[model samples]
Target: MSDRGRVPGQDYGVKMIPYEDLLKHEPLREFPEIDERTPATLLFTSGTTGPPKGGYHTHRGLVLHTLSTALAVKNPPVNASQDDVAMVLVPMYHVHAWGWPWSTMLNGHRKIVYPGRFDWGHILRVIHEEGVTFSAGVPTILYNLLMHPDSPKYDLSRLKFIVGGAALPEGLLKATQARGMTVISGYGLTETAPVLTIAYLRPEHRDLPAERRNEIYLRTGINIPLVQLRVVDEQDRDVPRDGKTIGEIVVRSPWLFREYIGDPEKTRNAWRNGWFHTGDAAVWYPDGYVKIADRLKDVIKSGGEWIPSLRLEDLISTHPGVNLVAVVGVPHEKWGERPVAIIVPKPGYEGRLTENDIKNHLMQFVEKGEIPKWWIPDKVIFVKELPLTSTGKIDKKVLRDQYKDALPK
Candidate 1:
């Protein structure tokens, strides 16, 4: 019990204090008045490519994020109000829990919650028993809830969830909706106070049928207020709003992080051309919706053509027998690189799914001209589980390392 909090081989140079002892010092109920521009807190990125980078936010930034994000969700469609209760699932260590703990609480809401440790069965119970109307998490958490052994026992019909940290797989969204939860996708990174867009349907599309509406929902979505978001090419010119061309997503907003701590060279590179580079690749649509295709590093370049790995994953996920899927570019003799899939089958479909099954399914889209035939993966390899980043995204980086030379040399 002695010095349990101390980590070996390091001196933090601060005395450790107990929570109970600190409480006895008479807590200050009122926050000290401080300049709006004063730095408040710092957060780190997911570090998918390298060591995590830090982002610092000011008091002013936090307030703006709170006001804007609260208003966005409180409006029609979401309509979160005093009646709403949040069992927020995103971790506090993760960029203000995507800004909910402060936003929702400060927005005059009556209550808030944390499900604690993210056990789906327990989370479902908390939602059912506590009447949690709103929540936010990455797509993997939602999938776990839908596939939980006791999932059918709980009533999740009243819940409306905000999904981010990764693209929502089409099949997962459909499955969640079928069980009566209203699921919406969101987009952001550690750099932008964690939320830059929410897929709120525009008024015209709001009247569309479910099939059509879901297509809109699946897109990365329209930007929230005060966020200047753009899809730009290497020249920093806007791509056409034709919904097919791919470009990097760049943004300028009031609440963005100040910089990556202690890395001036990388920081300067990220802020080139007057906007903070997002490193996410996406397509712009006519109705102001933007569909994220893949991380720039994750996009597949094969035979001089770009293939969006996310789009391929979405299409493959719709197969009933597929539980999870990842597509990565593997070095190939003929094409420089070719797409190969690694799939995790549903509970009973193990050893039953084949490369041909996926190819034939993709062929339907090819026949319809929805996708080029050459875009089909060269092979589909089945596995029991797929690797994930700390942020819960399917870790394509890991997959590429394992299968980079999959094709015969």
Candidate 2:
């Protein structure tokens, strides 16, 4: 170890060896024969919904997931090839960085660049300097990249982004497309080796109108190869594919976790009815794509009707003055829970972004029959920043707890 790399040995109760001294020892000749079904990794959830739960995966599961991910990227909208340079923006600890380390190597990608930390300006430089052509991360990462003041300094036309970890807001998707970068959406959970779906375009979709194509590109997407997915009602019956009826998403894939490590109760609840319950509310399209409405816990219950907060957040994000936004259900007397939006305004619009501005913005969409009138947020709170989880996703649980009483009776 270098002096700079050394830590206090006494505190850890272990002796530290310098790099030169460690190198003097002979390396092991024989390695253990590991089984494909052997326990591979134990990853924890991002804790966005609640307490983080452990997801235990196997070597076989991870390997199969890597192959599926490679296949998804190589197909349709992404068209990834060995000639394309790859950069994984997601942190390695987060769902094993969405399995890019294994997939990139398996696909024979020419070069792989790892941006050390997520400084937007620094990331922009890495993308431009290293000629990075492909990458994957959550929507928040993409938003930060585009919002940085120095982003225009780099030519990001060659970039391709695979957004996951959260729903891809339509406004953010359009902004990314405006930069000439191809942006696609994906959906998964930490328990499923995290790559269940990719919003790839089919051969027949080539000549579709731009508006319709954009709509499909931003959906949660169809099931990836070897994965069985369905949106089910409370009785575990499949939901109608009318695009208006919402149901819970359930899935079965070769790479899903076996259990929630040491928590059989949670494990049982997650694996109900012989399928892994995703607890995500979504609507299935006639074309077989799945569009997430909101998490089951995050849906706002107002006047005996459910309002998807993700829809509200997505529309609110389109507002020119809004930077980051989160919609949560707050306690209300007339309506059990009412929608409240917490917003981080753009640099020039601080203190100017008001409840009326957001309500008026959403009202336009409602009038266009794009969203329900009740889906509009009742209250809007301006803040400098929204709380983020350790994995860089919006910490809605914190927001819900902090502002549970924001609405009056």
TM-score, every prediction: 0.91, 0.92
Score candidate 1 by lDDT. 0.83
Q: Write the per-residue lDDT of candidate 1 for residues 1-409, one digit (tens) a residue.
A: 0123322122223233444566668877896676787666656788776678875677788889888788778644567888888878888877778999888887766668787777888888888888888888898889888888998999888888989988888988888888888888889888888789988766787689898889887889888888988899999999999999999999998988666766778788889888999989999998878999998888888988899888889999988898889899999888888999999988789988888999999999899999999999988899988888877777777899999877887
Task: Name the runs in model 1 displaced over 4 angstroms.
Answer: 1-32
| Tens-digit per-residue lDDT, 1-409, candidate 2 | 2222333222322333465776878875995677677656667788788787875677788988998888888876789899889998888888889999999998898999998887899999999989999998988899899989999888888898989998888888888888998998999999888999899998878789988888888899989888999999999999999998999999999899877755789989999988999989999989889999999988888999999989888889899898888999999988888899999998899987788999999999999999888778888999989889888889999999999888876
Model 2, residue 77: C-alpha shift (Å) = 1.5
- In candidate 1, what residue range of length 10 has the lowest lDDT sum? 1-10
Clashing pairs in 2: 1-18, 1-19
Off by over 4 Å in 2: 1-30
The best candidate in terms of TM-score: 2
Position 218, candidate 1: lDDT = 89
305 Cα displacement, candidate 2 (Å)? 1.1
